[model samples]
Target chain A: MASAREMRLRIKSVKNISQVTRALETVSASKVRKAINAVTATRAYATKAWQVLRHVAEQPGRDSLHPLLAQRKSVNNTLVVVITGDRGLAGAYNSNVIRFVSQRFDSNAVPVKYIAVGRKGRDLMLRRGKKVIAEFSNLPAAPTFGDVSTIGRLAVDEFSKGAADEVYLVYTDFVNMGRQITTVKKLLPLELEGEGLVEDFGNKSTGPTAAYEYEPDMRVILDEIIPRFTALQVYQAILESQASEHAARMIAMRNATDNAKELVGALQLAYNKVRQQGITNDILDIVGGAEALSAK
Target chain B: MTIRCEIISQDRTVFTGDVDIVVLPGAAGEMGILPKHAPVLTTLKYGVVKIRKGGKEEIFAVAGGVAEVQPDIVTILADRGSENIQDIDLERAEAAKKRAEEYLAKSAPADTDHYLIMEAALRRANLRLDVVRRYRKSGMRIPPSDN
Candidate 1:
C-alpha cells in the first residue's frame, strides 16, 4: 500500500496539472473563436476571387494567356506547402499532417520540395531529411493576409518559373467545434469547374454562364487577378488551419483536465485507504502493549 | 433605386449595404457607379472609395484589388481596406510610410520591383492619411485631386 504522505504529494501535483490544463483549455477556446471569425470574414473575398477566375477561365482559349491557368507539359517536380501548428500538444494535429505528407510522397520517382508554414512541419521535414526550400514559422496568433503573401508569392513564382510543376497546400480543415479533418488542396494550375465558384456566388447577378465586359480586356486583368487568386487561396487555407489548431488544442486540453481529475480522485481514494490502514496498525500495537503489561 | 455595395478586404467585409453611389479608384481613373450600371470588371488602384447613400456618405481607403460592378450590385474586393477613418492606425501608417521611404531612398535604381512595391506602399499610406485628414477637416468634401 502506498504511504499517506506520498499519496498526498501525488494528489497535489495532479491538482496542479489539472489547473494548468484547465487554464489552457480556456485560452484555446477564446482563441478558437477569433480564428473561426477570421476564416469566416475572408470567405466572401475568396469566393469572389474564385468566381472571377472561373469566369475568366471559361472564356474560350483564354487559358493560353495566363501562366497560372496553363497545364505544364510534364511533371518534373512538386512543391508541397504544409501548414502545421508552431507548438505541439494539440493531440495528433501536427503528426496527422506530417504523416499524411510522408504517406503521399514517393520521393524516389519525382523530386519534392517542402514549404513549411509552421515549426512542427519544418521539424518533421528536417528530421525526415526532405528537401525544404522555404520555411515560415511563428505566425501571429491571428494571421493577416500580408502574413501569408510571402508563402503564396514563393509558391506562385516556383510554379511559374518551371521550378515546380505542381503545388499543393496541406492543412487542417475546420468542419465544426468538435471535428477537424486534414485536407490536401491543389493550389496551382487553376482548377475550374463550371459550377464551382458560380454556385457559391449565386446571389450575384453574374449567373453561372454570363460573361461580363472586361474593363481593360480579359487578358490584362487576368494577369493581375490570377496571382491574387492563388495568394488568397493560400491565405484562406492558413486561416482555416489556424482555427483547426485552436479547436484541437482546446479539445486536447479539456481531455487532459478531465483525466487529471480522474487521477486526483483515485489518488484521494488511495490516500484514505492508506491512512485508515496506518490507524488500524497503531491501534493494534497499543492494545498488544497493554495486554502484555497486564499479563506481566 | 439603390445599389448594393460591398467592399471586402482580404481580412473582412469592410462595408456591405445599400448605397446610392459608389466611386471606385479604377486602374484608369476614378469611376462612379450608380444603380443600373453596366457589368464591368476592372482592377483598382490604391485610392479612396466613396459611397453615398441616403444623403450620408462613407469613404474607404482601399489598397488595390479588383472591382466587379453589376446592374444592382457592386463589389470591391481589395487586399486591404478600411471604411472608418478611426480604424486607420495613424502610427502604423506613418511608420510604414517612413520604412517605405527609407527603402526607396536606399534601393538601387536597377531594382524596379523593389522600388515599385515601396512606391505602392507609400501611395497607400498617403491615401489613407489624406482621406482621414480630409474627413477631419471638411466632413464630406472629397478634395478634387485626381479623377
Candidate 2:
C-alpha cells in the first residue's frame, strides 16, 4: 500500500495525464470531422472516374490501348505503396498497416520494393531492410491532389519503364467513424473488370451502356485520362487513410482519458481509506490518553 | 432541351446542373455540345469552359482534363479548376506563374517529372489569369501587371 502522500501524488499525476489526453481527444475529434468530410466529399468523383475507366476497359482490344491497362506476362518485380500516419499514438493505425504489408510480402517468391508514403512506414521498411525505392513523408493533414500526384506518377513511370511489373497500394479504408479496414488494392495494370470492381463501384452497372464517340480518337483521350484517373485513385486512398488516422487517434485518446479517470477514481478511493485510517489512529491515541487521565 | 452538365475536379464536384449548351476546350479545338448530341469523349486543354443557360453564361477555367459528353449528360473532369470566375485569385495566379517560371528557368531538364509539373503549373496559372481578364464583368478593372 502506498503512503497517503504517495497516493496523493499519484492521483495528481493521473489527473494531469487525463487532462492532456482530454485535450488530445478534443483536437482529434475536430480533425476527424474535417478528415471524414474530405473523404466523403471526393467519393462521388471517385465513383464516376471508376465508372469511366470500366467503360473504357470494356471495349474490345482494350489491353493494347495503354501501358497502364496492359498486364505483364509474369510479375517479376512488385512495388508496394504503403500509406501510414506520420505520427504515432493513433492506436494501431500506423502499425496495423505496416504489419499487414509485412505479412503480405513476407514470402520471398517475388522481388519486392516499397514506396513509403508516411514516416512510420518508411522507418519500418528501412528497419526491416526492405528495398524502399522512394520515400515521401510529412504530407499535409488534408493533402491536396497535387500533393500526392507525384507518388502516382512515380508508380506509373516505374510500371511503364518495366522496372516494376505490378504495383499494389496498401491503405486503411475509412468505413465509418468506428470502423476502418486495411485494404490492399492493385494500383498498376488497372483492375478494370473483376470481383472487386463490382463491390467498389456498386450495382450501378445494371444501367444500359451508351455507345460513346471519342473526340481526337480513343488512344489520345486514354493517354490523358488513364494517368489522371490513376492519380485520383491514389489521392482518394490518401484521403481515406488520413480520415482513418484521425478517427483512430480520437478513439485512442478518448480511451486513454477514460482509463486515466478510472485510475484516478481507484487511487482516490485508496487515498481516502489511508487518510481515514490515519484520522482513526489519531483519535484512538487521543482517546487512550483521555482514558488514562480519567482513570488516574 | 437542356443538357445536364457536371464539372468535377479531383477534390469535389464544381458544378452540376442543366445547361442549354456547354463549350469545352477540346484538345483538338473548342467543341460545343447541345442536347441530344452524339456521345463524345475528348481530352481538355488549359482554357475556359463556357456554359450557357437561358440568357446568362457561366465560365470555368479548367486545367488539362477530360470531357465526356453523352446525349443528355456532359461530365467535365478537370485536373484543377474553379467553379466560378470569382474564385480565381489574380494575385495568387500571378505569383504561381512567376514561381513556376523562375523554377523552370533555373532548373535543368534532367528531372522530367518536376519539369512537367512546373510546366503544368504555369499553364494552369496562365489559364486562370487569362480567363479572369477576358470574362470578368466590364465594370471590374484589371490589375496592373508587375512585369
Candidate 3:
C-alpha cells in the first residue's frame, strides 16, 4: 500500500493527466468535425470523377488510350503511398496503417518503395529499413486539393517512367465517427474493376449509360481527365485518412481521460482510507495515554 | 424549360440551380448551351462560367476542370472555383500570381511538375483577377493597377 503522501501525489498526477487528455479530447473533437466535413464535402467530386473514369474505361480499345490505364506485363517494383498521422497518441491510428502495409507487403516478391505522407509513417519506414522515395509531412489541418496533388503527380510520373510498375495507396477509410478501416487501394493503372471502387457510391445500377458527344475528342479529354481523376483520388484518400486520424485521436483521448478519472477515484478512495486509519490510530493512542494518566 | 446546372469545386458545390443557359470556357473555345441541348462532355479552361436564369446572370471563375452537359442537367467540376465574385480577393490573386511568376522564372524547367503546377496557379490567379475586373458589380471597388 502506498503511503498517504505518495497516494496524494499519485492522485494529483492522475488529475493533471486527465486535464491534459480532456483538453486534447476537446481539440480533437473539433478537428474531427472539420475533417469529417471535408471528407463528406469532397465525396461528391470523388464519386463523380470515379463515375466518369468508369464510363471512359468502359469504352472499347481503352487500354491504349492512356499510360495510366495501361497495365504492365511484369511488375518489377511497387510504390506504396502510405498515409499516417504526423503525431502519435491516436491509439494505433498510425501503427495500424504501418503494420497493415508491412504485413501485406513484407513477403511481396517485387521490390516495394514508399512515399510516406506523414512523419510517423516516414520514421517507421526508415527505422525498418524500407526504401522511402519521398516523404511529405506536416500537411495543413484542412489540406486543399493543391496541397496533395503533388503526391499524385509523383505517383503518375513514377508509373509513366516505369520506375514503379504499380502504385498502391494505404490509408484509413473513415466509415463513420465510430468506425475506421485500414484500406489498401491500387492507385496506378487506374483499376476500374470491382474491387478498387469504393462501394459507398451506392446503387451502382443507375450508372450513366448515355452515349455522349466528346468535345475536342475522346482521346484529348481522356488525356486531361485521367490525370486529374488520379489526383482527385489521392486528395480524397488524404481527406479520409485525416478524418480517421482526428476521430481516432478524439476517441483515444476520451478513453484516456476516463481512465485517468477512474484512477483518480480509486486513488482518492485509498488515500481516504489511509488517512482515516491514521486518524483512528491517533485517537486510539490519545485515549490510551489519557486512560493511563487517569489510572496513575 | 430550364437546365439544372451544378458547379462543383474540390471543396464544395458552388452552384446548383435551374438556369436558362450556361456559357462555359471549353478547351476548344467558349460554348453556350441551352435547355434540351445534346449531351456534351468537354474539358474546361481558365475562364469565367456564365449562368443565366430569367433576367439575372451568375458568373463563376473556374480554374481548369471538366464540364459534363446533359439534356436536362449540366455538371461543371472545377479544379478550383468560386461562384461568388466577392470571394475573389484581388490582393491575394495578385500576390499569388507574382509569387508563381517569380518561382517560374527562377526554377529550372527540368522539374516539369513544379513548373506546370506554378503555371496553372498563375493562370488561375490571372483568371480570377480577370473575372473580378470584368464581371464584378460596379459598386465593388476596382483593383489597383500595377505601375
Candidate 4:
C-alpha cells in the first residue's frame, strides 16, 4: 500500500514513459509507409530484370558464357550476407533472421563467412566468433542501389574468383505491415525459373512463333546483363529487409504504447484509491479529536 | 492500328499509352517501330524516345536498358528514364556530366570497370541535357540554359 505522495510520483513517471512510446509509435508508422513505397518501386524493376534474365537463360548454349551461371562440384566455402537493422527496438525482427541463419550453419560442415549490412547482425556474428569478412553499417534510411553495390561486387568477386563456392542472402520478407517472414535465398549460381532457381514471375512465355532477334548477339548482351542482374537482386533484398524492419518497429512501438497506456490507467486507479484512504484517515482523526473535546 | 507503348523504369512507369509510332535509340542507331513490326529484342542507348500519337508527340530521356517489341505491344525496361520533359533538371545533369568527364580523364585505361561506369554516366547525362535543351529551344515552358 503506497502512500498518496509515492503513488503520485509513480503515476507521473508512467505518464512520461507512455508519452515517449506514443511518439515513437507515430514516427515508426510514417517510416513504414516510406519503406513500403520503396519496396513497391524496386519490385517493378526487379520483375522486369528477372523476366529478361529468364528469357536469356532459356536460350540454347547461352548460359555457359557467364561464370555466375556455373555451379561448383563440391561445396567448400559459403558466404552469407546477413541484413538487419542498426537499431533493435523491433520485436523479434532482427533476432528471427539471425537465428534463422545461425541454425543453418554447422561448424562441422563447410566453412561459412559473413558479410553484415547492419550493426545488429554484425555484432551478433562477431560475438559468436564467426568469420566476418566485411562489415557495412550505418546505411541510410532509404538506400540507393549504388549504396549496396559494394556488397554485390564483393559477393560476385569472391564467387567468380573461386574464393567462395556459394553465396546466400539472409533477410526478412515484408508481406505487409502486420507480417514479415525471415527467408534465406541463394544469390549465386544464377538459376532461372526453368532451372528451379527463380520462382515463376507470372509472365506469359513468348511462343515459338515469335522468334526473337538480338541486336549484337545473345552472348554479348548476357555478358553485360548478368552482373546487373546480380546487383539488382541484392538491391531488391536490401529494400525488402528495410521495409520489414520498419513494419516490425512500428508494430513493436505500437504495442509498447498500448501497454503503457494500460499501466497508466491502472496506476491512476491505484493513486485515486490511496488518496481516498488518506482523506478518510484525516477525517476520522479530526472527528475523534472533536468528540474528546466536547466530552471534556 | 495503334500499339500500346509502355516505358517502365525502376521507380515508376514513365509512359504508357496507345501510340501510332515509336522511335527509340537502339544500340545500332535510331530505330522506329509501327504496328505489326517484327518480334525483336534489343538493348537501348542513352537518348530520347519520341512517341507520336494522333499528331501529338512526347519525348522521354532514357538510359541504358532493353526494349522488346511485339505485334501489339512495345515494352521498354530502362534502368532509369523520365517521360516528362519538365522533370529534367538541367543543372544536375550538367554536374553529373562534368564529374563523370573528370573521373574518366583522371582514370587509367587499365581500370575497365570504372571507365565503363563513368562512360555510361556521361552518356546518360548528355542525353538528359540534350532533351531538356531541345524542349527549351522549342519554346516549351522551360527556360534556356544560362551557360
Candidate 5:
C-alpha cells in the first residue's frame, strides 16, 4: 500500500521508462528491416550456391582437393567462433547464443580457441580468460562480405597450419520476423551429405557437363572453391545473426514498453484510489467539526 | 522461346529477364546456351557474359562462381558484381587495373586485400575496353562510371 506521494513518483518513473523503451523499439524495428533486406537480397544467390555445391558434393573424392573440405585424421583441437551483439536489451539474443556455446565447450581442456566478432562476446570471453585466437568488433550495421575477409583469412591460416583440427561457428540463426534461435555450425572439414565418401561422387552425379577442361586441373579449381565456400558461408551467417539481433531487440523492446504501460496504468488507478480516500476522510472530519459546533 | 536469366551479385540482383541466348565465360572455355538447353553446371571465369534478349544485346563481366542451367532457368552465382560495359569509366578502371597489378606484384598473401576484387576489376576493365574496341554494341560503352 504505497502512499499517494510515493505512487505519484513511481508512476512518473514508469512513464519515463516506457517512453525510453518505446523509442528503442522504434529504432530497432527500422534496423531490423534494413538487416532483413540485406539478407533477403542475397538469399536467392545463396540458394543457388547451395544447389551448385550440392551438385559438386555428390562427386567422387571431390572433397580431397579442398583442404577445408578435408576431414582431419583426428579431432585433436577444436576452435569455436562465437558472434553476439555488443549491446544488451535485445531480449535473450546474446545470452542465448553465449549460453549455448558455453554448453558446447563445457570445459577449458578441450583445446578450444575463440574468435569473437562483437564487443560483448569479446568482453565475456576475456573475463573468462579463454584462449581468444582473434577478436574483431565495431562492425557497421548490416556488414558486407568484405568485412568478413580478414577474419576468414585468419581462420583459414590457422586451419591450414594445423593450429586447429576443427572449427565451429556459433551465432543466432534467423527464423522469421519474431523468432530467432542460436545456431551452431561446423566450419572446418566439410561434412559430406550423401553415403560413403568413396561412393559419394559429391552431391552431384553427372557433375558440371559444360565440359570443363581445367588449365591446371580440377584439383586447383576445387582448392580455391573450398575455402571460398567456407568463408562465404561464414559471411552470410554473420549477416543473418546481425539481422536476427535487431529483430529480437525490436520485439523485446516493444514488449517491455507494453508491460511498462500496463504497470503505469495499474499504479495510476491505485494512486487515484488512495488520493480519493484521503480527500473523503478530510471532508468527513470537517463535517463532524461543523456538526459539533451546531450542537453547542 | 526466350529463357529467363538472372545476373545476380552480392549487393543486389543486377538483371533478370528473358534472353534468347546467354554466352558464359566458363572456366573450361566459352560456352553458349539457348532455350531448352541441357542441364549444365560449370565454374565461370572472369570475363564477359553476353546476353541477347529479343533485339537488345548486353554484356556483363562476371567473377568466379558456378552457373547452373535447368530447362527454362539459367542462374549465374557470381562472386563479384557484373559491372556492365556501358556503366564503366575507363580512367577509373585503368587506375583500378594499375592498383591490382601493383597488388599482384606483392609477394605476401596478406597484402592481397581482395584477390577476387582485383580480378573482378581487371575483368571489368578488359570487358569495357573490349566492348569499346568493338564497333557494335556501342550503347554498352556509355561509361556509367559515376554510378
Candidate 6:
C-alpha cells in the first residue's frame, strides 16, 4: 500500500497538472467562441457568394474564353492551397489535413506545388521536403474577406497563366463543439457542387433551385460573380477551419483537465485509506505493549 | 418617388433606407439617381455620396466599385464606407495623403500606380474633411477619431 504522505504528494501533483489544463481549457474555449461567432456572422455572405459561384460554374466563363478552364486527360502540374492555424495545440487539426494531402498527391505521377496559408502548415510541409509555391503568414486573429481574396486571386492567376493545371484546398470543417473534420476540396475548374450550409436560404427544410431574374444578362453577371464568389468561398473556409481548430483544442484540453481531476480524486481516496491503516497499526502496537506489561 | 439606398462597409451594412435622391461620385462624373432610374452599372470614385433620406441628408465617403440602380433599388458594391463622421482621423488622413503624394511623385513615370495611390490619398483626406465638417455642423460631441 502507498504511504499516506506519498499518496498525498501524488494527489498534490495531479491537482497542479489539473489546474494548468483547466486554465488552458478555459482560455481556448473563449477564443473558440469568438472565432465561432466571427465565422457564423459571415456564413450568410459566404453562402450567397457560393450561390453566385455555382451559377457561374454552371456556365462557360472567361476561362472558357481563356486558358484556365482548359482541361487535359493527363495531369502534369497541381497546386495545393494548404490552410491551417498559425498557432498549435489543436488535436489533429493540422496533422489530419497534411496527411490527407500527402495521400492524394505525394506521388511522382504529377508534380505538386503547395501554397501554405498559415505558419503551422508551412513549417510542417517544408520539413517534409514538399515544394511550397507561396507562403502567406501573419493573418489576423480572425481573417477578413480581403485576406482570402488576395490569396485566391493569386492561385487563380497562376492557373489561368498556365503555371499550374489544377488547384485544390485542404482545411478543416467545424461540425460542432466536440468535432472538427479535415476536408480536401478542388478549387479550380470550379466544382459543380459548390459548398455551403446546403439548403435554400432561410428555408432549411427545402432546397435552392435556379429561380431568379437576371437584369442585364446572365453571362455578364456570372463573369463578375464567379471570380468574387470563388474568392469568398476560399476565405470563408479558412475562417471556419480556424474556428473549429480552436474549439477542438479547447475540448481536448478540457477533457485532459477532467481526467487529471479524476486521477487526483482517486489518489486522495487512497491516501486517506493509507493514513487510516497507519493509525490502526499504531493503536494495536500500543495495546499489545500494555497487555505484555500487565502480564509481567 | 424615392430610392432605396444601402451603403455597406466590409464589416456590416452601414446604412439602409429610402431616400429622395442620391448623388454618387462616379468615376465618369457626378451621377444622380432618382426614383425609376434606368438600370445602369458604373464604377464609383472615392468621394462623397449624398443621400437625401427623408428631410435630413446624410453624406458618406465611398472607396470605389460598381453601383447598380433600378426604379426602386439603388444598390452599391463599394470597397469601403464610413458612417461615424466623428471617427475620421484628420491628422492621419493628411499624413497618408502627403505620403501617397510623395510616393506618387517618386514613382516611375510609366507606372499607372501613381494615379491610383494619389487618388486613394486624396479620397482619404477628403473623407476625413467631409466627416469632420459633418461632425461640426451637427454640434454633436465627437468621439475621438479613428483612422
Off by over 4 Å in 5: A105-111, A124-131, A194-216, B1-6, B15-21, B33-43, B51-59, B63-75, B83-126, B129-147
Q: In angstroms, how far off is A109's CA in candidate 5?
A: 10
CA shift of A165, model 3, Å = 2.3
The models' CA-based lDDT, in order, is 0.81, 0.82, 0.84, 0.78, 0.73, 0.69
Worst 10 residues of 5 chain B by lDDT: B138-147
Query: DockQ scores for all the models shown?
Result: 0.44, 0.49, 0.45, 0.46, 0.26, 0.08
TM-score, one value per model: 0.77, 0.80, 0.79, 0.79, 0.78, 0.67
Residue B110, candidate 5: how far off, in angstroms? 15
Each model's fnat?
A: 0.64, 0.72, 0.60, 0.62, 0.32, 0.00
Top model number, lDDT: 3
Tell me the TM-score of model 3: 0.79
Docking quality category of candidate 1 according to DockQ thresholds: acceptable
Q: What lDDT is obtained when candidate 4 is compared to the true structure?
A: 0.78
Can you write out model 4's per-residue Cα lDDT over A208-266, one digit (the tens) per residue?
Answer: 32556777675666667777777787788888889999889889888888888898899
Candidate 1's C-alpha runs over 4 A off are: A26-43, A102-112, A126-131, A175-177, A194-207, A217-219, B1-3, B18-23, B30-39, B46-63, B70-72, B84-147
lDDT of 6 by residue, A111-159 (tens): 8999998898999999999999899877887877765689888888877
Per-residue lDDT of A139-181 in model 3, one digit per residue for the tens? 9997988888999899888988999998888889898888899
Residue B93, model 4: Cα distance from true site in angstroms: 6.6
Q: Name the best candidate (by DockQ).
A: 2
In candidate 6 chain B, where is summed lDDT lowest over 10 consecutive residues?
A: B138-147
Which residue pairs of candidate 1 clash?
Answer: B30-B147
User: Alpha-carbon error at A271 in model 1, in Å?
Assistant: 1.6
- Model 1 agreement with the true structure over B48-142: per-residue lDDT tens digits: 88888667676778887899887878888877645556578888889989988888878658458778878888887887788788874434533
State the lDDT of candidate 3 residue by residue for B78-129, as single tens digits.
8865555767889999999999989988866745888887888888888889
Q: Which residue pairs does candidate 4 place in steric collision?
A: none
